[model samples]
Every structure is written in structure tokens, then in C-alpha cells.
Target: MSLLDIDGVSVDLGRAPLTRVLDEVSLRLRAGEVVGVVGESGSGKTTLARSILRSVPVAAGSLRIDGRDVRGLRGGTLRAWRREGAVQYVFQDPLRSLDPGVRVVDSIAEGLRIARVPSEERTRRIAAALRDVGLDPELAGRLPGHLSGGQRQRAAIARALVMQPRLLLLDEPVSALDAASRDRIIRTLIALRDAHRERLGMLVISHDIGSLAALSDRLVVLYRGRIVEDGPTRQVVARPRHPYTRLLIASVPVIGVAGADRTERAALRAAIDA
Candidate 1:
């Protein structure tokens, strides 16, 4: 069975003339597969992630994880499923996700604590998780504010890793960092996925096509709250099937041709608006 299945799902937000953010979206993720969801702002990428976590109301269709209906879960059952941490989310901002006042180790141990893991086991898992993300155990004593952007991001990743999640969802995981930091974080994620691919699947949401191209097995492009294209990463990048997808690629700033990239991107935006 697929680890995560989202079939013909639609989400509507706000009241009175509700706005439809997701329209008949169907996606399936298997264990060990890394799928990238890329799109411009207001494209429902974050909403899609929220739907999987059951953070938003689904107006139509079904969302299932490991063959269980996520939308049908209620009360303690839903809480317990969430505590199990089968689905872990790494927010775009690590500083916001990790408590500034809490020590890194404590933040990483929070999920295990809520799950009632023993002290010794939690400690072991926390150490292992930190190591998995290329963080030294000694750094665990520091607060989120003390670490560099990449380090803090890894710490956030470690917190998720400790849960041993079957499906991990990352929202723009590297977009807030400098180029070097972004590269390091991406490499860390790539290595982590490679090491845990047998049981771990990931859906990464980002506007950065270049990063997604490097880390994703397949790419799913969202435009105006709907999927415009879905295919192998290389294939989508090499030959985009949709106009929006092509414009997204063209917007990426090439090393020495950033000026042209910006101009093309602006023109594409104008055309899209028209």
C-alpha cells in the first residue's frame, strides 16, 4: 500500500462564499520516494501540506495515510495518531518551530516525551537524531538562537527524525538560508533520505526549483491551487509540459545572467496576470 494517499481532495477556506484552495488534487507517495511540490505564491502548496496533517477542513474527496482515513479521525483517536508521529512536519522557519528558550536537546525530545518514551531511550534517540542530521551532541545544550541558520534547520530536522516518521513533510526547508547554508541543508536531507529510504517518504514544498531538482525523485507542479504537471524530476526540468512550469524554470537566477532571469520572470508574471 502507498504510505500516503491523497485522492481527489479539495479544501475550501473561510465562510460565506468559501474560497476553494485545493481542487480535486490526487497524489500518492510510496515509501522511500521523495516528491517535490513546487509553485508560486497562493498556489496552495502549504494548504496541501496542511490537508495531509488534517489541519484544514476538506470540503471534498479523501485523504488517507497507511490506508487509514485522515479526515475521519476524531477525538482521542486523532490525537493519538498525531502523537504517534507517523507524519512529521518540519516548518520553513526553524527558529519559529523550535522554542527559543528551550535547549536543543529538550526540543528534540519533546515528541518522545509526549509519547511517554523512557528517559534513557529519549536520550539515545535524541543523540542519534542529531547525529543523523550531522549535528554534534555537544550542540544540544544551546538554544535555537545560538545556532546558525543551517544548524538550527538541522536541529529542527533532528526533532522530526527522532519520531522515526514514515512520511515527512517539509515546507520550504531551505529557503530562509544563505546559499552555502541552503546547499548544506539540502545535502543533509538527501543523505538522510538515502539512509532511511526503505521506510521513509518525503514531500517537500518549495518555490526553489533548483533545490527540488537536486533532491526530488519526482516533481509535482502546482499552479492556482491545482496540479499543472507531474513527472520525473529530470523530465520535468528538462522538458516542462506546462507553460507555468516552463516559466518557473526560466525564473531561476543563473550565475552570470541574473538580470535576464529577473526580466524574464517579470514578463512571465505580467503575462500570467493578463
Candidate 2:
């Protein structure tokens, strides 16, 4: 069975005539598989992620995690669902995700405390998670404000990993970082997935096609709140079938291009094609 299944899922913002942010989106992720959800801003990528976590209400269809219906859960059941660590989310901004007043170690340890993990085991797991993400254990006591952007992202990842989740939802998790820092974080994520094997599944949402191509096994392109293309990562990157997908892939800046010339030209061509 798939680890995560989203079927005909839709979200309406209840505006005039109800603005549908997501329209009958269906996706499935198997254990150990990494799926990339790629699209421009307002294409509902984050909305999809939020819906799965039950942070956003679904207007239609079903969302299931590990064979259980997410919509059926409530109160203690919902808490239990979270404690089971079936799904985890890493937001775009690590600084925003982490509490300004809390120490990094405590932030990483919060999940364990809520799950009632033993104190000793929690400490060991927290340290290991931080180390796995390429952060020094010594920095655990420092506040989020003290760490570099890369370190903060690593810490956010550590917070998710310490929960031992089966599925992870990454919503533009590296988009806010510098190129060097983004590269490091991407490598760390790939390494973590490799180390976990079939025990983990990931849904990576990003506008950066190059990064998505590097890390995803498959790619799904969302346009105007609907999936327009879905296929293997290599195939989608090399030969995009949908016009929007093609345009997005083409818009990626080539190395050595001065200023906005190449990208602007590509954008113009894409607009013409669209």
C-alpha cells in the first residue's frame, strides 16, 4: 500500500463563487519514494501540504496516511495520529518555524517530550538527529538566532527527524537560503533519505526545478491549482509534456548568462507559447 494517498482533494477559500486553490488533486507516495511537487507561487503546493497535515480543511475527497482516513480523526485521535509520526512537515523558513525564545536543543526535543519518549533516549536521539543533519551537537544549546541560515534549516530538519516520521512534507524548505546553504541542506536531506531507505517517504514542494530534479524520484507539475503533468523526474526534467512544465524547465537560468537576458528571453518565449 502507498504510505500516503491523496485522492480528488480540493480546497476552496470560500470567496465569491468560492476560489478553489486546489482542484481534485490526486497523488500517491510509496515508502522510501521521494516525489516533487513543482509549480509557480499560488499554484497550491503549500495548500496541498497543509491539507495533508489537517491544518487546512479539504473541500472534497479523501486524504489517507498509512491506511487511516485523516478526515475521520479528531481530538485525542488526532493527537495520536501526530504522535505516531505518520507525517511530518518542514516549513520554508526555519527561523520562523523555530521559537525565538527557545534553545535549539529544546526545539529539537519538543516532539519527543510530547510523545513521552524517555528522557535519556530523547537526548540521544536529538543529538544524533542534529549530527545527521551536519550540525554540531555542541550548538544544540544555542538559540535559533545564533545559527547560520544553513544551520537553522538543519535544525528544523532535525526537529522533524527526531520524531521518526514515516512521511515528510517539505514546503519550499530551502527556497529562502543562499545557494551554498541550499546545496548543503539538499545534500543533507538526500543523505538522510538514503540512510533511512524504505522507512521514509518524502514530498518535496519547490519552485526550483534544478533542485527538485536532483532530489526527486518523480515530479508532479501543478498549474492553476491542478496537476498538469506527472512522471519520472528525469523524463519530466528532460522532456516536459505540459506547456507550463516546459516553460518552467526552460526558464531555469543557464550558467554564465549575464544579468536577466537569457531568463527574460525564455520567459518571453514561454509567455508566447502559453
The best candidate by TM-score is 1
Per-residue C-alpha lDDT of model 1 across residues 1-274, encoded as one tens digit per residue: 9999998999999888999999999988999899999998999999999999989989899898989998899889989899999999999999777999999889999999999999999988988898889998888789888899999999999999999999999999999999999999889988988999899999999998889988999999998888989999989988877768878888765411235566677776676666
Clashing pairs in 2: none
Q: Assess each prediction's global lDDT (C-alpha) against the native.
A: 0.90, 0.86
lDDT of 2 by residue, 140-221 (tens): 7899999998899899989999988999999897889999998998899889889887799999999988789888999999
Q: State TM-scores per candidate.
A: 0.94, 0.92
**Clashing residue pairs, backbone N/CA/C < 3 A, model 1:** none
Off by over 4 Å in 1: 253-274
Give the 10-residue window scoring lowest on summed lDDT in candidate 2.
Answer: 253-262
Please report the candidate that would top lDDT against the real structure: 1
